[model samples]
Target chain A: MKFDDLKKLHQKKYRQQFGHFLVEGEHLVLELQRALTRGTLASGSVTLYVSERYANFASPFEKVLLNDRQMSQLSDTKSPQGIVALVPLPEAPTTIQPAGKAIYLWQVQDPGNLGTILRTLAWFGGFRCLLSPGSVDPYNPKVVRASMGAIFHVPLELDVPLAALPDRFARIGCLDLHGESVVADNFVAQDCFVFGNEAQGVPREALSAMGASAFTIAGQGAIESLNLASAVNICAYEIQRAQG
Target chain B: MKFDDLKKLHQKKYRQQFGHFLVEGEHLVLELQRALTRGTLASGSVTLYVSERYANFASPFEKVLLNDRQMSQLSDTKSPQGIVALVPLPEAPTTIQPAGKAIYLWQVQDPGNLGTILRTLAWFGGFRCLLSPGSVDPYNPKVVRASMGAIFHVPLELDVPLAALPDRFARIGCLDLHGESVVADNFVAQDCFVFGNEAQGVPREALSAMGASAFTIAGQGAIESLNLASAVNICAYEIQRAQG
Candidate 1:
């Protein structure tokens, strides 16, 4: 692929067209390599791009060394690490059935929020992240960066609709302002957990139609909302806490 | 202040120079109004700037009308709500005596993280936030926006030294990767909870010098670290959960 075409992976459309996205920085590239070794990421689907400084870094994947200008063009951040990876968009989960409950994010918009949630889900293990249509692209550089490479570990399913959740999981729970406490007895028993958009939370009628139980974090404050990612992180922790 | 001067609030220095910061959008403007009525904010220190669209909106604060361009200049968002407030920097907390335990943030850098943490602090109530000298400006526009108006309700103290914590809180606690579980019986007994910087975390030496107890959230995952705001948010929820 042309170096010029690789730079285009910064945008979602180009990433889709080229069937790959750019993962920049040494830490994330190392994570990609780890994922490759773990067999979670498909082998032979990654291409390492490094500058002169990392020309000798040992890696199994094919390496392409770029000059300073070429490295800058392929890098997303202002301070380029001079090392990046061209990772293929994760192919559909093969025979390896990823473990755990489902976390359905309903059009959650912030790339940072999605990435942070992925990190949280990855930390707890045994969970897959599902993004609703109209959500920010999970493969966006910002989301991948914010995930701290959790993007390579956690199972992700994009364009999973809010409406499809009911058929997939018999018990679904969601956060609501007036719901029962998340620590309540029934909270952790759900098969799937749904979180809403940052600005407009999940519609009441939609949640009711899906028969999803309501659970609130239970707080005492004059403010009305929590950041989308923060709410998900708390829920993930609660679910893990209850298991022990 | 001149219209030209208001534009300068976009930068942190000018915010300090003018002794005020901007809060944009209708929700936040309403939140500021709520704070004013609740006596959390001083009566005369707020000035609302509105475009013709909100010319008749009712509020006790003095209102200034701005043209579309002026409103755009004042707003940090792409879509102006045609409403913004110039709120005075909170003077050193005087006789009001903010309630509850202290949350000491040591040099938290991201505006969104600091703002989200403030929101979490406000949501849980009974917590006054303390920022170390190098932390992000709590009143920066990005912080204010991300806070979703919690900045008005949460009591904040700035430029606090981390070393001063030892003299103030007799029982101090900080999160560590290998510490006891956060859910332990004694976690709620702390007078102050210290959260570290996003990248470096609280140095072991500093934590040791302060005689702070180490508590971990405890999880099983291959990926390491949580987003700073998410960590603080989870801690706030856990503290509140234990209290009940």
Candidate 2:
């Protein structure tokens, strides 16, 4: 296909209408190939798009073919890693399965921060996400880029109200620097760890509803609170370890 | 001052000449107030510069008040938190101290990632940062926003060569997923932990000289590698635990 045709997928409008988005880099290409061979990919597969120059550059993955300019256009990166693919959007899962662990975000504002936390949740491998009403749009381009494709893999629910959260989850915990130390108690249930807005802790109403006080990361105060992603990683790791 | 006069500070030339930049929001204002009261601000000082409407709102800190139009000129935020400060630049430390724990970033491209790592280092509290050539400029506006004022607290040295790094510190370790289990070893280095380019691990020559192979965050198939900031946080915590 022509390079111009590949570049068209960079737009969200095009991606939504066509149900495909671009994936770049040799590593992701290899993953797509492996997932396809293993039948791990969904029924409707992606066209394995690659530039001829990239194909000649010693990649282990077969099926190397696509236009160079098109590959560059489809890629989100400034310095394209020379490979791009038109991958089908995995169907967004709608059901809130009672996953063994969950992290609920309360009005978290920054797209980059939200994206980083999503990527961390996926990295640790055991939690799902529920976004409060005021949170940044998860589909924002910056969020997608920071998530490193984890947005596709992680189970995410948007526009979910904080009020609706308790009925759907087992035990909910909120992360606050001024509250109880996260280390003191054993998190016994399949838990939902809540991280509030970066500037504010969970709202008083959200805290009151959860019934458990806030838990803080014990650290020196060079700053007021932990980065949202760091807080998620620490809380998720502790919860995972406790479950074991 | 006119709002137009303050708004012009967002330009690089104006900021450089004045040696002042704008910080907006309640959190940063409160933190800067604390820093000022404690006399921690050395590079210069903060000019509270708030609008009248914000004055009606209770302020957590003692601030130099300003009118809304005046405050608007000084603010870079679209929706100014009604509070903005012309904060002094943090004093750069002389002589990169061989603090036993340090993270050296080489050519880390993204400003947000760099800022996130800075916040992570500050949260963990023991780690210092060294930026090799080509790393994102720490002063970039995106970095400052993502850092949440961590730029003031985290000690950093920029444009240092990788060749000179091993000699300046004790243990030198590189993050490579294929090398060794990070959990398997007590990464008790009084030296430097080097995180390479986002897409590439440490350079081959730097790898051999660092006296270690690689270390990885244990995870399943979703992530090929943890984000740079996330990896730094996980490893730093592991190192702290191993030492204790």
Candidate 3:
């Protein structure tokens, strides 16, 4: 790939056109290498870019050297970490549903929230993140950065439709006010969990149509809502605890 | 107060010197009004600033109209909400710990993380936020905005010391990798919970000296750590669930 293309990877449409995304910083690059070694990512699908400071970082992947100025240009953060990886987007396994409970996010907008939620899901394990059609792109640089490298570990399915969830998961659940307590026994039994936008929660008509069960995280009604990431974090933790 | 003084409230030193903080946006201004009416905030300690659009907004507090440029000048967000409130900082009670379990944050720095954590604390209610000396100022503009008005609902004690924790709470708890599970019954009976910084967790020396009980949120350990706000959120939910 041309050096010009690496800069373009910072933008979403260009990333889509090239079918690769930029993973900057030593932490994410290390994770990319580890994932490739673990066979989670294909061996030859990554190209590592490094400044002279990181040129000697040992790895099996092909290396491209960028002068400090070039590295800074390709980096998104104010303080460039001197290393970046261009890795192929993971292909969805269309023939199979992933072997875990599904977490469906309906049009979550905040990049930090999406990234943090992905980290939470990966930490708890046994879960695949399914993003609704209007959701923020998982490969967007901010999401990738905020995931703190969990973007590589957690399985993600893009453009997953909220309307299609009913046909897919027999038992879908969401958090709401007048719902079963998350501590309740059956709250742990859902095959999939759905969360809504930060401002607009899963709507009433959609909830009724999907026949989705509702669950509650008990709180003192002082504040109207929890941060979207916090809500998902609590749900993911609750699911993990109930199962364990 | 002068317009110059109000603009300076964006900085921590100015906020402290003037003994007031900026709460921007319509949601926060309404929350300030609600809080004042509920007598949670003392009467006569607030001044509302609004653009022409919000000049007619209902409020018991004193209101000042600023031209759009002035409103924009006082606003921190890219898109100003045309309403701002100058609220007196909530004074901490010297004689007693507030009536709730304390959530002691040790040097948390991120404005968004602190705000989101405050929302979590408020949503769970029955919890007081204790910020260690070096933590981000709760009154920072970004914290105020990100909190979505929960900053008004959550009781906060600032500049609380880590070393003073033992003298304050009888049984302090913190999350650690090798510890009793958060689902354990004993985790429910804590007087306070201590969470550490984003990068550096509660130091071993401090944890040992405080004799803080350790609790774990079970995870598959694919990621090294959960986001600090997410960790606190999960803990708060677990505590609420166990108690309820």
Scored by lDDT, model 3 comes in at 0.87
Higher-TM-score candidate of 2 and 3 = 3
**Candidate 3, B1-244: lDDT as tens digits:** 9998889988889988988888888888877777776667755778889999998988877889999899998998888889898888877766576687888999999999999998998889887789999999988888987888888888888898889989978998988776898899989899899888899888979889889999887788787889999989988888888778
Candidate 2 local lDDT, residue B64: 69
A169: Cα error in model 1, Å: 1.4
Comparing to the true complex, what docking class would candidate 3 get?
high
DockQ top scorer = 3
How high is each candidate's TM-score? 0.95, 0.73, 0.97
Q: Give the poorly placed runs of model 3, Cα more than 4 Å off.
A: none
What lDDT tens digits, residue by residue, belong to model 2 across residues B1-244? 3456556666656665666667777766666566555555663345666676666545444466776665555666666667776765555666657455878888999887788788877776777788997777676666777778777667777788888876776567778776566766545643677788778877777668666546666666676667887777777666765665
Rank ordering of all candidates by DockQ, starting from the highest: 3, 1, 2
> What TM-score does model 1 achieve against the real structure?
0.95
lDDT of 1 by residue, B1-244 (tens): 8889999998989999989889898889999988887888965778899999899999988999999988888889889989999888888887444558888999999998998898888888888899999899898888998898998888888998888888777899998787889889788888789998889788889889878999988877567787888888888988888888
Q: What is the lDDT of residue B195 in candidate 3?
A: 88
TM match of model 3 to true structure: 0.97
Clashing pairs in 3: none
Best by TM-score: 3
lDDT of 3 by residue, A1-244 (tens): 8889889998889988999999998888877776776666745768899999988999887889999899899999899999999889888866566688889999999999999999999889888999998899999999998999888888888998888898888899987766888888898899999888898888879888889999887787777888899989998888888888
Error of 1 at A107 (Å): 1.1
Ranking by lDDT: 1, 3, 2
TM-score of the B chain in each candidate versus the native B chain = 0.95, 0.80, 0.96
Tens-place lDDT digits, model 1, residues A1-244: 8888998999999988988999988899888878877877866778899999999988887999899998888888888898999999987666333458788899888899899999998888878888888999999999999999999989888888788887778899998787989999799998889888888888889999989899998777589988888889999999989887
